[model samples]
Target: MWKKPLKPVTKKAVKTKLILLYEDIVCDGTEGCKRHKLVGKKYFGGLYEGSERNEDLWLEVQQYIYDNYDTEYLKNVYIAGDGAPWSVAGCRVLEKSKFVLDKYHLGKYIYKATTHLDDSQQAAKEFIYGAINERDFDGVMRLLQKCYASTDQEYKKKEVTECARYIKNNWLGIMVRIDDGGAVWGCSAEGHISHVLSARESSRPMGWSKKGVDWISHLRVLTRNEQKIIDLMEYQDKKQRKKNRIECEDQLIQDVQKRKSSRNEEVLRKAIPGLEKKQFSWMRSIINAGGIIA
Candidate 1:
Protein backbone atom coordinates (compact mmCIF):
# COMPACT_ATOMS: atom_id res chain seq x y z
CA MET A 1 0.00 0.00 0.00
CA TRP A 2 1.27 3.46 -0.95
CA LYS A 3 1.29 6.15 1.74
CA LYS A 4 -0.90 9.15 1.09
CA PRO A 5 0.37 12.68 1.64
CA LEU A 6 -1.76 15.16 3.60
CA LYS A 7 -2.27 18.70 2.27
CA PRO A 8 -1.55 21.64 4.53
CA VAL A 9 -4.39 23.78 5.80
CA THR A 10 -3.82 27.42 6.73
CA LYS A 11 -5.95 29.44 9.15
CA LYS A 12 -6.07 33.23 8.97
CA ALA A 13 -7.81 35.89 11.03
CA VAL A 14 -10.67 37.87 9.49
CA LYS A 15 -9.50 41.34 8.54
CA THR A 16 -11.80 44.17 7.49
CA LYS A 17 -10.87 45.74 4.16
CA LEU A 18 -12.59 48.23 1.89
CA ILE A 19 -14.11 46.75 -1.27
CA LEU A 20 -14.36 48.54 -4.62
CA LEU A 21 -16.12 47.80 -7.92
CA TYR A 22 -15.37 49.35 -11.30
CA GLU A 23 -16.33 49.01 -14.96
CA ASP A 24 -13.66 47.56 -17.24
CA ILE A 25 -13.87 49.73 -20.32
CA VAL A 26 -11.57 48.69 -23.15
CA CYS A 27 -9.12 51.37 -24.19
CA ASP A 28 -7.10 51.72 -27.41
CA GLY A 29 -3.75 52.96 -28.74
CA THR A 30 -2.47 54.86 -25.70
CA GLU A 31 0.00 54.20 -22.92
CA GLY A 32 -2.69 54.76 -20.27
CA CYS A 33 -5.15 52.73 -22.36
CA LYS A 34 -3.33 49.40 -22.54
CA ARG A 35 -6.26 47.01 -22.64
CA HIS A 36 -9.55 46.41 -20.86
CA LYS A 37 -8.82 48.87 -18.04
CA LEU A 38 -10.75 49.36 -14.84
CA VAL A 39 -11.73 52.93 -14.04
CA GLY A 40 -13.30 53.95 -10.74
CA LYS A 41 -13.46 56.86 -8.29
CA LYS A 42 -14.54 56.48 -4.67
CA TYR A 43 -17.27 58.69 -3.27
CA PHE A 44 -19.82 58.69 -0.46
CA GLY A 45 -23.13 60.56 0.03
CA GLY A 46 -25.45 61.95 -2.59
CA LEU A 47 -24.08 64.41 -5.12
CA TYR A 48 -27.16 66.55 -4.51
CA GLU A 49 -26.30 67.07 -0.87
CA GLY A 50 -23.63 69.40 0.49
CA SER A 51 -21.34 71.73 -1.49
CA GLU A 52 -18.73 71.07 -4.20
CA ARG A 53 -18.80 67.24 -3.88
CA ASN A 54 -20.21 66.70 -7.36
CA GLU A 55 -17.71 69.15 -8.82
CA ASP A 56 -14.83 67.35 -7.14
CA LEU A 57 -15.95 63.89 -8.38
CA TRP A 58 -16.24 65.18 -11.93
CA LEU A 59 -12.70 66.57 -11.77
CA GLU A 60 -11.36 63.09 -11.00
CA VAL A 61 -13.59 61.41 -13.63
CA GLN A 62 -12.72 63.91 -16.35
CA GLN A 63 -9.02 63.60 -15.63
CA TYR A 64 -9.28 59.82 -15.94
CA ILE A 65 -11.20 60.20 -19.19
CA TYR A 66 -8.69 62.59 -20.70
CA ASP A 67 -5.66 60.56 -19.79
CA ASN A 68 -6.82 57.14 -21.03
CA TYR A 69 -8.95 58.29 -23.94
CA ASP A 70 -8.49 60.34 -27.10
CA THR A 71 -9.72 63.93 -27.62
CA GLU A 72 -12.51 62.66 -29.88
CA TYR A 73 -13.46 60.33 -27.06
CA LEU A 74 -13.86 63.41 -24.88
CA LYS A 75 -16.30 64.87 -27.42
CA ASN A 76 -18.45 61.76 -27.09
CA VAL A 77 -18.20 61.24 -23.34
CA TYR A 78 -21.03 58.93 -22.31
CA ILE A 79 -22.03 59.65 -18.73
CA ALA A 80 -24.34 56.90 -17.48
CA GLY A 81 -26.44 57.69 -14.42
CA ASP A 82 -29.78 56.88 -12.80
CA GLY A 83 -32.87 59.11 -12.56
CA ALA A 84 -31.42 61.40 -9.92
CA PRO A 85 -31.48 65.13 -10.69
CA TRP A 86 -27.94 65.38 -9.33
CA SER A 87 -26.76 62.84 -11.92
CA VAL A 88 -28.25 65.05 -14.58
CA ALA A 89 -26.62 68.15 -13.13
CA GLY A 90 -23.28 66.36 -12.83
CA CYS A 91 -23.42 65.42 -16.52
CA ARG A 92 -24.04 69.04 -17.57
CA VAL A 93 -20.69 70.21 -16.19
CA LEU A 94 -18.78 68.14 -18.72
CA GLU A 95 -19.28 70.16 -21.91
CA LYS A 96 -19.11 67.11 -24.16
CA SER A 97 -20.34 64.40 -21.80
CA LYS A 98 -23.80 63.19 -22.82
CA PHE A 99 -26.10 61.99 -20.04
CA VAL A 100 -27.56 58.51 -20.44
CA LEU A 101 -30.16 57.16 -18.05
CA ASP A 102 -29.15 53.81 -16.62
CA LYS A 103 -31.13 51.01 -18.26
CA TYR A 104 -31.40 49.14 -14.95
CA HIS A 105 -33.68 51.83 -13.46
CA LEU A 106 -35.92 51.58 -16.50
CA GLY A 107 -35.98 47.79 -16.11
CA LYS A 108 -37.45 48.26 -12.63
CA TYR A 109 -40.36 50.13 -14.17
CA ILE A 110 -40.75 47.31 -16.71
CA TYR A 111 -40.93 44.76 -13.86
CA LYS A 112 -43.35 47.00 -12.01
CA ALA A 113 -45.55 47.21 -15.10
CA THR A 114 -45.54 43.40 -15.43
CA THR A 115 -46.77 42.91 -11.86
CA HIS A 116 -49.80 45.20 -12.36
CA LEU A 117 -50.75 43.81 -15.77
CA ASP A 118 -53.61 41.31 -15.60
CA ASP A 119 -52.61 39.62 -18.89
CA SER A 120 -50.07 39.71 -21.75
CA GLN A 121 -47.25 40.27 -19.25
CA GLN A 122 -44.66 38.57 -21.47
CA ALA A 123 -45.69 40.66 -24.48
CA ALA A 124 -45.39 43.84 -22.43
CA LYS A 125 -41.87 42.86 -21.36
CA GLU A 126 -40.74 42.12 -24.92
CA PHE A 127 -42.22 45.37 -26.26
CA ILE A 128 -40.50 47.50 -23.60
CA TYR A 129 -37.06 46.08 -24.50
CA GLY A 130 -37.75 46.30 -28.23
CA ALA A 131 -38.79 49.97 -28.02
CA ILE A 132 -35.87 51.02 -25.87
CA ASN A 133 -33.37 49.10 -28.04
CA GLU A 134 -34.84 50.60 -31.20
CA ARG A 135 -34.21 54.05 -29.70
CA ASP A 136 -37.96 54.74 -29.98
CA PHE A 137 -38.20 56.90 -26.86
CA ASP A 138 -41.68 58.16 -27.79
CA GLY A 139 -42.74 54.58 -28.61
CA VAL A 140 -41.83 53.50 -25.09
CA MET A 141 -43.77 56.43 -23.62
CA ARG A 142 -46.70 55.71 -25.90
CA LEU A 143 -46.70 52.01 -25.00
CA LEU A 144 -46.70 52.80 -21.26
CA GLN A 145 -49.38 55.43 -21.79
CA LYS A 146 -51.47 52.84 -23.60
CA CYS A 147 -50.92 50.53 -20.63
CA TYR A 148 -52.19 53.34 -18.38
CA ALA A 149 -55.20 54.30 -20.55
CA SER A 150 -56.33 50.71 -21.10
CA THR A 151 -56.35 50.02 -17.37
CA ASP A 152 -59.62 51.19 -15.81
CA GLN A 153 -58.36 50.29 -12.33
CA GLU A 154 -57.10 53.43 -10.54
CA TYR A 155 -54.10 51.78 -8.85
CA LYS A 156 -52.76 50.16 -12.03
CA LYS A 157 -53.22 53.39 -13.98
CA LYS A 158 -51.16 55.36 -11.48
CA GLU A 159 -48.32 52.86 -11.59
CA VAL A 160 -48.33 52.68 -15.40
CA THR A 161 -48.53 56.46 -15.71
CA GLU A 162 -45.51 57.01 -13.48
CA CYS A 163 -43.60 54.47 -15.53
CA ALA A 164 -44.44 56.39 -18.69
CA ARG A 165 -43.36 59.70 -17.23
CA TYR A 166 -40.03 58.15 -16.11
CA ILE A 167 -39.22 57.36 -19.72
CA LYS A 168 -40.57 60.71 -20.93
CA ASN A 169 -38.57 62.91 -18.58
CA ASN A 170 -35.37 61.02 -19.28
CA TRP A 171 -36.02 60.97 -23.03
CA LEU A 172 -32.55 62.20 -24.02
CA GLY A 173 -30.86 60.08 -21.43
CA ILE A 174 -32.75 56.90 -22.26
CA MET A 175 -31.42 56.50 -25.79
CA VAL A 176 -27.85 57.73 -25.65
CA ARG A 177 -26.12 55.25 -28.00
CA ILE A 178 -28.88 55.55 -30.59
CA ASP A 179 -29.64 59.28 -30.17
CA ASP A 180 -26.16 60.67 -29.43
CA GLY A 181 -22.75 59.42 -30.56
CA GLY A 182 -21.98 57.64 -27.32
CA ALA A 183 -20.35 54.34 -26.42
CA VAL A 184 -22.30 51.09 -26.32
CA TRP A 185 -21.92 49.79 -22.77
CA GLY A 186 -24.00 48.74 -19.80
CA CYS A 187 -23.98 50.71 -16.54
CA SER A 188 -22.74 48.73 -13.56
CA ALA A 189 -23.68 51.27 -10.89
CA GLU A 190 -26.09 48.77 -9.34
CA GLY A 191 -23.36 46.19 -8.64
CA HIS A 192 -20.97 48.91 -7.63
CA ILE A 193 -23.32 50.34 -5.00
CA SER A 194 -24.65 47.08 -3.63
CA HIS A 195 -21.73 44.66 -3.68
CA VAL A 196 -18.85 47.14 -3.56
CA LEU A 197 -19.86 50.00 -1.27
CA SER A 198 -22.76 48.64 0.79
CA ALA A 199 -21.07 45.31 1.50
CA ARG A 200 -18.32 47.18 3.39
CA GLU A 201 -20.01 50.38 4.50
CA SER A 202 -23.76 50.04 4.96
CA SER A 203 -24.94 46.41 4.76
CA ARG A 204 -24.39 45.84 8.48
CA PRO A 205 -26.14 47.14 11.60
CA MET A 206 -23.84 50.12 11.74
CA GLY A 207 -23.77 53.79 10.90
CA TRP A 208 -20.99 56.05 9.67
CA SER A 209 -20.20 59.74 9.90
CA LYS A 210 -19.83 61.70 6.65
CA LYS A 211 -16.05 62.02 6.91
CA GLY A 212 -15.65 58.42 8.03
CA VAL A 213 -17.60 57.14 5.02
CA ASP A 214 -15.58 59.33 2.67
CA TRP A 215 -12.24 58.17 4.11
CA ILE A 216 -13.09 54.46 3.89
CA SER A 217 -14.37 54.81 0.33
CA HIS A 218 -11.08 56.51 -0.55
CA LEU A 219 -9.15 53.55 0.85
CA ARG A 220 -11.13 51.18 -1.38
CA VAL A 221 -10.45 53.31 -4.44
CA LEU A 222 -6.72 53.57 -3.70
CA THR A 223 -6.47 49.78 -3.32
CA ARG A 224 -7.80 49.37 -6.85
CA ASN A 225 -4.89 51.48 -8.11
CA GLU A 226 -2.36 48.69 -7.26
CA GLN A 227 0.65 49.19 -4.88
CA LYS A 228 -0.91 52.47 -3.71
CA ILE A 229 -2.49 50.75 -0.74
CA ILE A 230 0.90 49.37 0.35
CA ASP A 231 2.38 52.86 0.19
CA LEU A 232 -0.45 54.22 2.32
CA MET A 233 -0.09 51.48 4.94
CA GLU A 234 3.68 51.99 5.05
CA TYR A 235 3.20 55.75 5.47
CA GLN A 236 0.82 55.22 8.39
CA ASP A 237 3.18 52.71 9.97
CA LYS A 238 6.02 55.27 9.77
CA LYS A 239 3.81 57.84 11.52
CA GLN A 240 3.05 55.34 14.32
CA ARG A 241 6.73 54.49 14.71
CA LYS A 242 7.63 58.16 14.90
CA LYS A 243 4.99 58.72 17.55
CA ASN A 244 6.29 55.81 19.62
CA ARG A 245 9.85 57.10 19.25
CA ILE A 246 8.82 60.55 20.46
CA GLU A 247 6.97 59.05 23.44
CA CYS A 248 10.00 56.93 24.40
CA GLU A 249 12.24 59.99 24.17
CA ASP A 250 9.84 61.97 26.34
CA GLN A 251 9.81 59.18 28.97
CA LEU A 252 13.61 58.95 28.96
CA ILE A 253 13.89 62.72 29.46
CA GLN A 254 11.56 62.55 32.47
CA ASP A 255 13.50 59.63 33.94
CA VAL A 256 16.79 61.45 33.46
CA GLN A 257 15.39 64.62 35.10
CA LYS A 258 14.25 62.54 38.14
CA ARG A 259 17.67 60.85 38.44
CA LYS A 260 19.44 64.22 38.18
CA SER A 261 17.25 65.69 40.94
CA SER A 262 18.00 62.73 43.25
CA ARG A 263 21.73 62.98 42.50
CA ASN A 264 21.74 66.76 43.17
CA GLU A 265 19.98 66.21 46.52
CA GLU A 266 22.60 63.62 47.54
CA VAL A 267 25.41 65.93 46.36
CA LEU A 268 23.92 68.82 48.41
CA ARG A 269 23.64 66.60 51.46
CA LYS A 270 27.26 65.51 51.10
CA ALA A 271 28.46 69.11 50.34
CA ILE A 272 26.66 70.55 53.37
CA PRO A 273 28.16 68.66 56.31
CA GLY A 274 25.99 68.33 59.52
CA LEU A 275 22.84 69.43 57.58
CA GLU A 276 20.97 66.27 58.70
CA LYS A 277 22.44 66.53 62.16
CA LYS A 278 21.33 70.18 62.53
CA GLN A 279 17.80 69.34 61.31
CA PHE A 280 17.51 66.45 63.83
CA SER A 281 19.02 68.58 66.59
CA TRP A 282 16.36 71.34 66.05
CA MET A 283 13.51 68.75 66.11
CA ARG A 284 14.98 67.01 69.19
CA SER A 285 15.25 70.34 71.06
CA ILE A 286 11.63 71.15 70.26
CA ILE A 287 10.48 67.66 71.41
CA ASN A 288 12.58 67.92 74.56
CA ALA A 289 10.89 71.25 75.46
CA GLY A 290 7.49 69.51 74.92
CA GLY A 291 6.41 72.32 72.62
CA ILE A 292 3.26 71.72 70.61
CA ILE A 293 3.37 72.02 66.79
CA ALA A 294 1.31 75.22 67.12
Candidate 2:
Protein backbone atom coordinates (compact mmCIF):
# COMPACT_ATOMS: atom_id res chain seq x y z
CA MET A 1 0.00 0.00 0.00
CA TRP A 2 1.62 3.26 -1.16
CA LYS A 3 -0.10 5.88 1.04
CA LYS A 4 1.41 9.33 0.62
CA PRO A 5 1.08 11.97 3.29
CA LEU A 6 -2.12 14.08 3.28
CA LYS A 7 -1.50 17.46 1.71
CA PRO A 8 -3.70 20.53 2.19
CA VAL A 9 -4.92 22.51 -0.82
CA THR A 10 -6.61 25.91 -1.29
CA LYS A 11 -10.13 24.50 -1.27
CA LYS A 12 -9.79 23.17 2.27
CA ALA A 13 -6.68 23.85 4.30
CA VAL A 14 -7.80 21.55 7.12
CA LYS A 15 -8.93 18.69 4.89
CA THR A 16 -6.10 16.41 3.80
CA LYS A 17 -6.07 13.49 1.37
CA LEU A 18 -4.01 10.35 0.70
CA ILE A 19 -3.45 8.35 -2.46
CA LEU A 20 -2.87 4.64 -1.90
CA LEU A 21 -0.68 3.63 -4.86
CA TYR A 22 -0.61 -0.05 -5.75
CA GLU A 23 2.95 -1.28 -6.28
CA ASP A 24 4.87 -4.53 -6.63
CA ILE A 25 7.96 -5.68 -8.56
CA VAL A 26 9.02 -9.14 -9.68
CA CYS A 27 12.68 -10.09 -9.92
CA ASP A 28 14.62 -13.00 -11.41
CA GLY A 29 14.78 -15.79 -8.82
CA THR A 30 17.33 -17.85 -10.72
CA GLU A 31 20.38 -18.63 -8.60
CA GLY A 32 22.92 -17.46 -11.19
CA CYS A 33 20.91 -14.50 -12.50
CA LYS A 34 23.88 -12.25 -11.45
CA ARG A 35 21.48 -9.43 -10.57
CA HIS A 36 17.85 -9.28 -9.55
CA LYS A 37 16.60 -8.36 -13.03
CA LEU A 38 13.21 -6.66 -12.66
CA VAL A 39 10.65 -8.70 -14.59
CA GLY A 40 7.39 -6.86 -14.06
CA LYS A 41 5.59 -4.32 -11.88
CA LYS A 42 1.99 -3.33 -11.11
CA TYR A 43 1.45 0.26 -10.01
CA PHE A 44 -1.99 1.63 -9.22
CA GLY A 45 -3.68 3.60 -6.41
CA GLY A 46 -6.86 5.45 -5.41
CA LEU A 47 -7.18 8.69 -3.48
CA TYR A 48 -8.98 8.48 -0.13
CA GLU A 49 -10.17 11.86 1.03
CA GLY A 50 -10.07 12.45 4.79
CA SER A 51 -8.77 9.80 7.21
CA GLU A 52 -9.76 6.22 6.53
CA ARG A 53 -11.43 4.22 9.28
CA ASN A 54 -9.21 1.81 11.25
CA GLU A 55 -10.82 -1.35 9.82
CA ASP A 56 -11.01 0.23 6.35
CA LEU A 57 -7.27 0.85 6.25
CA TRP A 58 -6.49 -2.83 6.97
CA LEU A 59 -9.16 -3.95 4.55
CA GLU A 60 -7.70 -1.66 1.92
CA VAL A 61 -4.28 -3.31 2.32
CA GLN A 62 -5.79 -6.79 1.98
CA GLN A 63 -7.64 -5.78 -1.16
CA TYR A 64 -4.49 -4.12 -2.53
CA ILE A 65 -2.51 -7.37 -2.17
CA TYR A 66 -5.27 -9.61 -3.56
CA ASP A 67 -5.65 -7.34 -6.60
CA ASN A 68 -1.95 -6.77 -7.31
CA TYR A 69 0.34 -9.32 -5.66
CA ASP A 70 0.49 -13.06 -6.28
CA THR A 71 0.42 -14.51 -2.77
CA GLU A 72 1.72 -17.86 -4.01
CA TYR A 73 5.05 -16.32 -5.02
CA LEU A 74 5.42 -14.02 -2.03
CA LYS A 75 8.13 -15.91 -0.15
CA ASN A 76 10.67 -13.49 1.30
CA VAL A 77 8.47 -10.71 2.60
CA TYR A 78 10.18 -7.58 3.99
CA ILE A 79 7.61 -5.00 5.08
CA ALA A 80 8.86 -1.47 5.68
CA GLY A 81 7.41 1.87 6.65
CA ASP A 82 8.01 4.97 8.77
CA GLY A 83 7.77 4.51 12.54
CA ALA A 84 4.10 5.40 12.70
CA PRO A 85 1.75 3.19 14.75
CA TRP A 86 -0.47 2.84 11.70
CA SER A 87 2.55 1.67 9.72
CA VAL A 88 3.50 -1.00 12.27
CA ALA A 89 0.01 -2.48 11.91
CA GLY A 90 0.85 -3.31 8.27
CA CYS A 91 3.67 -5.63 9.37
CA ARG A 92 1.43 -7.55 11.82
CA VAL A 93 -1.03 -8.63 9.13
CA LEU A 94 1.66 -10.48 7.20
CA GLU A 95 2.98 -13.75 8.57
CA LYS A 96 6.68 -14.66 8.67
CA SER A 97 7.84 -11.26 7.40
CA LYS A 98 10.59 -9.02 8.65
CA PHE A 99 9.52 -5.49 9.53
CA VAL A 100 12.32 -3.14 8.61
CA LEU A 101 12.39 0.28 10.23
CA ASP A 102 12.67 2.43 7.14
CA LYS A 103 16.27 3.60 6.95
CA TYR A 104 14.93 6.90 5.69
CA HIS A 105 12.96 7.49 8.88
CA LEU A 106 15.84 6.28 10.97
CA GLY A 107 18.14 8.70 9.21
CA LYS A 108 15.58 11.47 9.59
CA TYR A 109 15.45 11.03 13.35
CA ILE A 110 19.23 10.73 13.44
CA TYR A 111 19.52 14.00 11.53
CA LYS A 112 17.19 15.70 14.02
CA ALA A 113 19.37 14.50 16.89
CA THR A 114 22.64 15.44 15.21
CA THR A 115 21.62 18.63 13.38
CA HIS A 116 22.94 20.69 16.28
CA LEU A 117 26.25 18.88 16.04
CA ASP A 118 26.91 20.31 12.52
CA ASP A 119 30.29 18.79 11.46
CA SER A 120 29.80 15.80 13.77
CA GLN A 121 26.58 14.82 11.94
CA GLN A 122 28.52 12.75 9.43
CA ALA A 123 30.18 10.81 12.24
CA ALA A 124 26.79 10.16 13.84
CA LYS A 125 25.45 8.88 10.48
CA GLU A 126 28.43 6.55 10.09
CA PHE A 127 27.88 5.27 13.59
CA ILE A 128 24.23 4.50 12.83
CA TYR A 129 24.81 2.85 9.46
CA GLY A 130 27.86 0.84 10.50
CA ALA A 131 27.63 -2.97 10.32
CA ILE A 132 29.58 -3.30 13.57
CA ASN A 133 26.42 -2.29 15.43
CA GLU A 134 24.34 -4.87 13.55
CA ARG A 135 22.67 -6.25 16.69
CA ASP A 136 24.25 -3.84 19.18
CA PHE A 137 21.34 -1.50 19.85
CA ASP A 138 22.80 -0.62 23.26
CA GLY A 139 25.78 0.74 21.41
CA VAL A 140 23.44 2.88 19.34
CA MET A 141 21.76 4.14 22.52
CA ARG A 142 25.13 4.88 24.03
CA LEU A 143 25.95 7.05 21.01
CA LEU A 144 22.69 8.95 21.61
CA GLN A 145 23.72 9.32 25.24
CA LYS A 146 27.02 10.81 24.11
CA CYS A 147 25.13 13.40 22.02
CA TYR A 148 22.78 14.11 24.94
CA ALA A 149 25.68 14.65 27.37
CA SER A 150 27.51 16.95 24.92
CA THR A 151 24.47 19.21 24.42
CA ASP A 152 23.36 21.78 27.00
CA GLN A 153 20.36 22.97 24.97
CA GLU A 154 17.00 21.41 25.97
CA TYR A 155 15.83 21.14 22.33
CA LYS A 156 18.96 19.18 21.38
CA LYS A 157 18.48 16.93 24.40
CA LYS A 158 14.83 16.34 23.46
CA GLU A 159 15.78 15.36 19.93
CA VAL A 160 18.35 12.91 21.24
CA THR A 161 15.87 11.41 23.68
CA GLU A 162 13.27 10.97 20.95
CA CYS A 163 15.76 9.22 18.71
CA ALA A 164 16.86 7.02 21.60
CA ARG A 165 13.28 5.94 22.33
CA TYR A 166 12.58 5.30 18.62
CA ILE A 167 15.64 3.11 18.26
CA LYS A 168 14.91 1.17 21.46
CA ASN A 169 11.34 0.44 20.41
CA ASN A 170 12.19 -0.62 16.86
CA TRP A 171 15.55 -2.13 17.66
CA LEU A 172 14.32 -5.46 16.32
CA GLY A 173 13.91 -3.81 12.92
CA ILE A 174 17.00 -1.59 13.11
CA MET A 175 19.42 -4.34 12.08
CA VAL A 176 20.77 -4.62 8.56
CA ARG A 177 21.19 -8.31 9.30
CA ILE A 178 19.12 -9.74 12.13
CA ASP A 179 21.48 -11.89 14.25
CA ASP A 180 24.05 -11.14 11.47
CA GLY A 181 22.80 -14.11 9.39
CA GLY A 182 23.31 -12.30 6.03
CA ALA A 183 19.63 -11.55 5.36
CA VAL A 184 19.04 -7.81 4.80
CA TRP A 185 16.06 -5.62 5.62
CA GLY A 186 14.88 -3.01 3.12
CA CYS A 187 12.50 -0.09 2.47
CA SER A 188 11.80 2.44 -0.33
CA ALA A 189 8.65 4.23 0.86
CA GLU A 190 10.33 7.61 1.41
CA GLY A 191 11.90 7.58 -2.05
CA HIS A 192 8.75 6.39 -3.84
CA ILE A 193 6.47 8.88 -2.02
CA SER A 194 8.81 11.78 -2.84
CA HIS A 195 9.38 10.90 -6.50
CA VAL A 196 6.00 9.43 -7.45
CA LEU A 197 3.15 10.44 -5.13
CA SER A 198 4.28 13.86 -3.86
CA ALA A 199 5.71 14.85 -7.25
CA ARG A 200 2.28 14.56 -8.89
CA GLU A 201 -0.48 14.90 -6.27
CA SER A 202 0.88 17.24 -3.60
CA SER A 203 3.33 19.52 -5.44
CA ARG A 204 0.66 21.95 -6.62
CA PRO A 205 -2.05 24.29 -5.30
CA MET A 206 -4.74 22.09 -6.87
CA GLY A 207 -7.53 20.63 -4.75
CA TRP A 208 -9.56 17.53 -5.62
CA SER A 209 -12.96 15.93 -5.17
CA LYS A 210 -13.14 12.21 -4.34
CA LYS A 211 -13.67 11.20 -7.96
CA GLY A 212 -11.21 13.70 -9.47
CA VAL A 213 -8.34 12.76 -7.14
CA ASP A 214 -8.90 9.03 -7.64
CA TRP A 215 -8.85 9.33 -11.43
CA ILE A 216 -5.62 11.33 -11.34
CA SER A 217 -3.93 8.86 -8.97
CA HIS A 218 -4.83 5.90 -11.18
CA LEU A 219 -3.60 7.75 -14.30
CA ARG A 220 -0.25 8.54 -12.64
CA VAL A 221 0.37 4.84 -11.93
CA LEU A 222 -0.73 3.87 -15.44
CA THR A 223 1.81 6.29 -16.97
CA ARG A 224 4.71 4.38 -15.39
CA ASN A 225 3.60 0.97 -16.66
CA GLU A 226 4.84 1.45 -20.25
CA GLN A 227 4.56 -2.26 -21.00
CA LYS A 228 0.86 -2.25 -20.20
CA ILE A 229 0.04 0.91 -22.19
CA ILE A 230 -1.27 -1.07 -25.17
CA ASP A 231 -3.48 -3.22 -22.90
CA LEU A 232 -4.81 -0.11 -21.13
CA MET A 233 -5.56 1.59 -24.47
CA GLU A 234 -7.46 -1.47 -25.67
CA TYR A 235 -9.44 -1.59 -22.42
CA GLN A 236 -10.34 2.11 -22.77
CA ASP A 237 -11.51 1.54 -26.33
CA LYS A 238 -13.85 -1.22 -25.15
CA LYS A 239 -15.25 1.12 -22.48
CA GLN A 240 -15.83 3.84 -25.10
CA ARG A 241 -17.63 1.36 -27.35
CA LYS A 242 -19.80 0.21 -24.44
CA LYS A 243 -20.60 3.84 -23.58
CA ASN A 244 -21.60 4.54 -27.19
CA ARG A 245 -23.87 1.50 -27.30
CA ILE A 246 -25.57 2.45 -24.01
CA GLU A 247 -26.05 6.05 -25.18
CA CYS A 248 -27.58 4.79 -28.45
CA GLU A 249 -30.02 2.58 -26.50
CA ASP A 250 -31.00 5.52 -24.26
CA GLN A 251 -31.59 7.78 -27.28
CA LEU A 252 -33.73 5.08 -28.95
CA ILE A 253 -35.82 4.76 -25.77
CA GLN A 254 -36.28 8.53 -25.65
CA ASP A 255 -37.25 8.65 -29.34
CA VAL A 256 -39.86 5.90 -28.78
CA GLN A 257 -41.47 8.05 -26.04
CA LYS A 258 -41.63 11.22 -28.20
CA ARG A 259 -43.88 11.99 -31.22
CA LYS A 260 -42.20 12.82 -34.57
CA SER A 261 -44.22 16.10 -34.80
CA SER A 262 -42.76 17.25 -31.47
CA ARG A 263 -39.24 16.51 -32.71
CA ASN A 264 -39.84 18.32 -36.04
CA GLU A 265 -41.54 21.46 -34.58
CA GLU A 266 -39.52 24.69 -34.50
CA VAL A 267 -38.87 25.53 -30.81
CA LEU A 268 -38.77 29.29 -31.68
CA ARG A 269 -42.52 29.34 -32.53
CA LYS A 270 -43.45 29.46 -28.81
CA ALA A 271 -40.74 32.07 -28.10
CA ILE A 272 -42.70 34.89 -29.81
CA PRO A 273 -46.36 35.72 -28.99
CA GLY A 274 -47.24 37.86 -32.09
CA LEU A 275 -44.64 37.45 -34.82
CA GLU A 276 -45.73 38.15 -38.41
CA LYS A 277 -45.66 35.30 -40.96
CA LYS A 278 -42.82 37.13 -42.77
CA GLN A 279 -40.60 37.21 -39.64
CA PHE A 280 -41.31 33.50 -38.87
CA SER A 281 -40.37 32.53 -42.43
CA TRP A 282 -37.21 34.64 -42.27
CA MET A 283 -36.07 33.03 -38.99
CA ARG A 284 -36.92 29.48 -40.17
CA SER A 285 -35.09 30.15 -43.47
CA ILE A 286 -31.98 31.19 -41.50
CA ILE A 287 -32.29 28.15 -39.16
CA ASN A 288 -32.47 25.77 -42.17
CA ALA A 289 -29.63 27.54 -44.06
CA GLY A 290 -27.50 27.80 -40.87
CA GLY A 291 -26.80 31.49 -41.60
CA ILE A 292 -27.47 34.94 -40.07
CA ILE A 293 -30.41 36.70 -41.83
CA ALA A 294 -29.64 40.11 -40.25
Q: Global lDDT of each model?
A: 0.61, 0.62
Tens digit of per-residue lDDT, candidate 2, span 11-100: 543222232333344445776564442234445455534335433555555666666678888664455665556556556655445566
Stretches > 4 Å off in candidate 2: 6-39, 47-74, 130-132, 176-186, 209-211, 222-294
- Top candidate, metric lDDT: 2
TM-score for predicted model 2 compared with the true structure: 0.57
**Tens-digit lDDT track of model 1 for 43-68:** 32321123365566555666665675
Model number with the top TM-score: 1
Candidate 2: residue 178 Cα off by (Å): 3.9
Global local distance difference test of model 1:
0.61
Counting clashing residue pairs in each candidate, in order, gives 0, 1
* Whole-model alpha-carbon lDDT for candidate 2: 0.62
Which parts of model 1 are misplaced by more than 4 Å?
Answer: 1-48, 67-75, 133-138, 150-155, 180-182, 227-294
